[model samples]
Target chain A: MPPLKSAATPVASVLAADARHTVTVVLNGTPRTGQAHPRLLLSDFLRHELGAHGTRVGCEHGVCGACTVRIDGVAQRACLTLAVQADGRRIDTVEGLSQSNQGPTEGRMTALQEAFRRHHALQCGFCTAGILMSLSDYLGRNPKPTEEELRDMLSGHLCRCTGYAGIVRAVMDVTGQAAACDTRSGEAAHV
Target chain B: MKPASFDYLRPATVADALAALAAGGDDARVIAGGQSLMPMLNMRLVQPRLLIDLSRLEELRTLKADSGWLSVGAAVTQAELLSRPTLRDEVPLLAAALPWVGHFQTRNRGTVCGSVAHADPSAEMPLCLVATGGAVVLRNAKRRRTVAAADFFVGPLTTVKAADEIVESVRFPLAAAGSGHAFREVSMRHGDFAITACAATVDGTQASLAVGGVADRPTLRSWPLVGGALLSDLDAALNAFAWDLGGDDDQHATARYRRDLVRRIGRTVLEEALSCRR
Candidate 1:
C-alpha cells in the first residue's frame, strides 16, 4: 500500500480535468489553437493560456456578468463556457475591443469607452471591461434602443461602482438620442 | 471552483450520441448548453468519467411547429428560441416567461431542454412547460418516449431520466387563440433566481395558475374564471388551491412567507392576465 500523504504534502492538483483535447478558436480577429482540459473554462483559457487578462472572471457561476464575452456575435458568459466547447468558434473579448478601437495610442478610445470615461460611468472599473464588451455587441445589433430595452439589457451586468445612470446616458449619447459632447474627445454625455 | 477531469466526446448525431451514452453508461453525462451543468461542475457537485457533448447533434436543434404542439429541440438555446417570431406570436406566455429565465448572457447558451433536464425548482422553462401542459421527449439507444412536464420533474435537480437516456426535445402545445398570459417573479435582484414567482393564463373562462420558487417545483392549478370570483376573492382562491406544494424555509424566505406571497403574486398575475383578456 502507498504510504499516506503527509499533512504537509501538497496534493497533486486534482488531476487537471483531462487535458487531452485540442481547441481552436478565432479570438478577436486572430486564430488561436491550444490543448486544454475538457473542464477548463473558456475564461481561464483566455486569461491563462492565451494571456488575455482583459477578460475578467467574476461569479464564475454566471450570475455576475463581469466575464461576459462575445461568441459568434452573441453576448455570452465566458465563465460558464468550457474552452473545449469554444472549439471552432469565434470569440470576442474586451481586449479585442480595445485593440480594434485603437485606444489612447491612436489618441482615441472607442466611442463607448470614451462615453464611459466622460459620463463617470466607471468608478473602480473592475466591471468596465465586461460591461463595455456586452454593450458594444448589443449596440452593434441594436443601434437605437429604447430606455426599457436598454435597462433590460443592462440588467444582465452588475456594476457596484457606477449606479448605471451614467452608462445609460453614455449609450444614449452615443446613439445620438441626446446631445453628445465633441466626437474628437469621444467623451460626451450626461445622465 | 474548477471542474473535475473528464473526457469530452462530441457525437455528430442523436444515434451516435445514444451509442456513446450507452457505452459510457453510469459514467457519462450529456452537456448541451452547459449553463446549468457547468455551474454544477465548477462547484464540484458532480464528477463524471466521460461527458458526451451534444452540441454537434444538429438533429436536436431544430425548432418546428405541428398541428398540436410546438417542438423545441434539446440543444436549442433559450435566446435562439426566443428570437423566433412565430414562437413569440404562437406562444405569448413562453415569450413573456423567457426573459425572466436568466440574463442575456446565460440565455445565450442556456437551452430549454437543458433547463427541463436540470429541473431547477425556480427555473422558468420547466415551470412554463408544466403550466402550459407541455411534454418532454426522451430517448435512449433502445427507444424513445414522452413524459408530461408535470411528471418529468421528480424533485429539485432531479428527473426520471435514466442514466443512459437523453432529453431529445420538449413539445409545448400551441396556445389556443384568445389566450392572455402574464408572468411575474420576486427576486432579490433583477437577474437573480426568483424568491417567488407567479404565471397565469386566461383561456376563455378558464384560468391556469402556476406558482414557482415556493416549492421544490412549480405548483400548478386551474379554475374557472367564473363571475370574477378568482379576481375578487384572490386570497381565498389561492387558499383554495390544492397547493400540494412542498415548501421549505431557507435564506430567501420562509414557507409561511412563500405561502403568503403565492397568494399576493398569484392574485397580481391573474389580475394582470385577465385584465388583458384576449
Candidate 2:
C-alpha cells in the first residue's frame, strides 16, 4: 500500500465550491493521478475526465444500476460513490472488459458481447452497458448461477423497453454456452 | 445534486479526527465510508461546516473478538463486517441482517459505525447492536466513554453521540452456546429500508428482544423463559412493549398496524431463536 498523502492546502471553503483532492486510481489498466472535488461523482470522473463514457449515469441516486462499474472487482454504483473515495483503488469500466483480447483478437468484442448479439439482448441499448458490467462481475463469481440467482442478481438493474426477457436469455446463453432455450434448466426459457 | 459547501478534513488518526471534531464544534460531521453522509449531503439534509473524513483512519476500521466480546470499528463497512469470518461464526445475526441493508452497492460503501451514528430506526445494524447488548465507545478531545446500546439511542434518527465526540468503536457480547439469534423485517423491496424490523436473542432461559422501524428508537424488552403459552406471552409482551414506547403511525403503517406487526414479527423471531437452540 502507498503512503496516504495529506491535502496540499485547503482548496475552498464551500460544498459546491470545487475543492481539490488528490486521487490516485488505476483506470482500466493504467495508473492515473488527478485532482477532483469532494463532490465529484465517480461516474463523472470516468465519463468526463478519462473519457470512458461507456459507464452511463441513469439515476444519480443508488436506486438505478445504470452507472454500475467494478471497483476493485466489486460491482458498485459509480454515481453514488465519490471520486476521492476511489483513491489508490482499481476501477474497471466496460472499456477494461474488452482489453483481454490480443493480436487477431485485438479490439474484438468479448464473449459477453457476442452472446448479447446472438441472443438479441439489447433494444434501445440505454441500459446495456451497466447491465453487462453488473452481470460480468456477477457471472465472474457465479458462472453457473441458478435461474433464481440470475434473477436476484439482475434485480438491481432496470430495462424499460426490453422487458428483461432478452437480457436474461443473453445471460443464460452466455453462461450455458448454448444458442437458445438454455436447456441446462428445465424451466421454460422466455427468449 | 451537489452537496452543500463545507470544509473537508481527512484525519489520518483517531486523535486527529477527534481534535478536528472538537475544533469544528457542533457544525462538524464525521464521515466514514460516506455511504450515508454523502447521500444526506446531496439531499441537503445536513450541511456541516467541516467534514471529518475518517476513511484514512485505519485504526478505527477493524473487527476483533476476544474474551466473549466482539469489538468493531465504527468506520467498518457493512460489507467488511458481513464478510468477516469471525463475525459470521460468532455473530451470525449481524451477518444475516447485513444483506438486507440497502443492497450490495450501498453496503460496499456504508460503514457499521456510520449506520449506528445515522440511527435510522429502519436500519438493521442498529437493531442488531441493540439486541446484542452492544456498547458504543465515544472519544472526544479530552475524554473517552462508552454508552450502552439501550441508552445510546434517544429517539428516531437521534442518539446520545455528542457533537464534539466521535464514535471510535462498538463492542458486542459474544453469544454463548444455547444462545440463538434471529432478525426479520418487511420492506417494499429487498433492498429498501425496513418498514418494521425485529431482532431477538435467546440465551438459555433468558431473552432479549429489540424492535425497530415502528418506533422512534429501537424498543427493547427482556424476560425469563416462561413455561407455558410461549407465543401468546411473547405477543402480549411485544404489544405492551410497543404501547409502552408510544410508537406512532407513519406513512408505512398505522400505529396500531405497526404494533400488530411488531407483535407478529417479534413472536416469529423469538420462536425461530428458540427452535435454533434445540
Candidate 3:
C-alpha cells in the first residue's frame, strides 16, 4: 500500500457543477483568465470567454478535428477538454501562428500560409486553421516528411474543400520538396 | 452535443482518488487522459454525478520494465508510451498497434491504461492486451487486484471494474526469444474505428490470434503448429472462429464482411508474425 502524505493539505477538492470556477491559461503568450462551470468545454471557453475565436468546434464528441489546438506544445482537441482542465496550461490556437511574426492586425503570413495561398489549399476556409495548426506542429517535428507521411499525418484533420490534394502540395512545398510539386500541378490550381 | 452537469474533483494523490471514488459511490468516474471519456461525456453517453481527475497524481505516470513485465501506469499517455525508444524491440505487437488507435492528436492525450479501462470493442489497446496475455491492475480504497485482460472486459464499453475501483496500471508480459508479433486492422478511414482488428503472436510451436470489432469483446483462439498440411486445418479453425464471433450488420459493414475480414486478415497477421519469428 502507498503511504499517505503527512502534509496537512486537503487531499481532495470538488468544484460544484452549478458553481463557476476561475480558469486561467497562457493564451498565445498572454495570460488570460475566465470563469466557467464544470461542464464548459475548452473550445467554448477559448471562443466565448477568452476571445480566441480562431479555434473552431465542429463535432464536439472528438471525431472532427475542427477544434484542434496546441496544449503544452502538442495538438489536442479543445472540444474534448474541459475549461477547468486547462486552467494552468499553455494553449496555442491558430491565432498564435500568424501573430508570432507580426501583431494580429498586421498582414504578414508565415511560409506555410503563403504556400497554402499559392496552392489554393483552402476554399471554404472553415477547416484551415485546425489543419494549419496540426501541420505546423507535425512539420516542426518532421521537417522533411514525404508526401505519403504528410497525408498520413493529415488524417487527423478533415477538409471538405480542395480535396486535400492542394493541401498536400502546399505541405510538400513547405518541406523543400518543390521538385515533386509539378507532378500534381494540373490538380493544384483547380483544387 | 454537450455534457450534463457534473461536479469535478481533482485529487492530488491516488489515496485521495480512491477515497473520493468510495465516497462518491456509483456516481463517480475516474478520468486520466480523457481521450475516450471526453467523447462519451460530450455526447452524454455516460453522465456521472462526480468525475475524479487523476492527471495530477504523478505516481500513476510510470512506464518501465519490472522483472519480466512492462508495467504501464494509468496516467501514461499513449504517445508517451509509443515514444519509448525500446518499445519496438520490447513489444512489437503494441508498437504496430499503437499508431492505429484513433489519430496522432488523440494519442498525445489518451492514456494506455485509460483505453484498457474504457474497453471499447474496436479499440487497439484492449485487443493488444488480450492478444499478449496482459493484466490490468485495479485498486480500490481497501485493496488492489489484478485481472487478466481476457477477463477484464465483460462487454462493449463495459468492464469488471467495480464502481469504487480505479485502474492503476497494466502489465504486458515481455516477449521472449523465438517469439514474434503482428497487428492489423481495417477501418473506413485512417483514424476511424476498426471494422475488424486482428493481432497474432507466434511463439515456439504455439500460435494465438485475437480478433476484435467482430464481437462484443476481444476473443482469442490458439492453434498448434503442425508439420504437414497445416494451412487447411488452420483455415477451417479460423472459419469456425469467425462464425463463432458473429458480428452485427451495421452501417460500416455487414456481418458477412466482418467474418471475411477475420478469415483473411487473421491468416495474414499470423503469417506475418510467423515470418518474423527467430
Best by DockQ: 3
Q: State TM-scores per candidate.
A: 0.90, 0.88, 0.94
In model 1, pairs of residues that clash are A17-B5
> Which candidate, 2 or 3, has the higher lDDT?
3
TM-score of chain B of each: 0.95, 0.94, 0.97
Can you tell me the CAPRI class of model 1?
Answer: acceptable
Using lDDT as the measure, which candidate wins? Answer: 3
User: CAPRI band of model 3?
Assistant: medium
Query: After superposing candidate 2, which stretches have Cα over 4 Å from the reference?
Result: A1-22, A119-121, A177-191, B228-232
On DockQ, the stronger of 2 and 3 is 3
Superposed by TM-score, candidate 2 places the C-alpha of residue B246 at a distance from the truth, in angstroms, of 3.7
Counting only residues 3 or more apart in sequence or on different chains, how many pairs clash (N, Cα, C under 3 Å) in candidate 2? Answer: 4
Each prediction's whole-model lDDT (CA): 0.81, 0.77, 0.87
Angstrom error at residue A147, model 2:
3.6
Candidate 3 per-residue lDDT, tens place, B98-214, comes to 999889888888899999999999999999999999999999999999999989999998999998998899999989898989899999998899999999998887789999999
Give the C-alpha interface root-mean-square deviation per candidate: 8.1, 4.3, 1.9
RMSD for each model, in Å, please? 7.7, 3.7, 4.1
lDDT of 1 by residue, B1-278 (tens): 78888877776568878887899889889999989999888998888888887765778888998987999998899988888988766777899889888887788889999999998899899888888889999999999999998888888888999989999999988878777788998888777788887888888777888988877887788888777545556578787662556578899888887777787788888888877765
Q: Give per-residue CA lDDT, model 3, range A100-124, as digits (tens).
A: 8865656578889988987888888
TM-score of chain B of 3: 0.97
For the predicted complex of model 3, DockQ is: 0.62
> Chain A vs. true chain A, TM-score per candidate?
0.81, 0.83, 0.85
By lDDT, the better pick of 1 and 3 is: 3
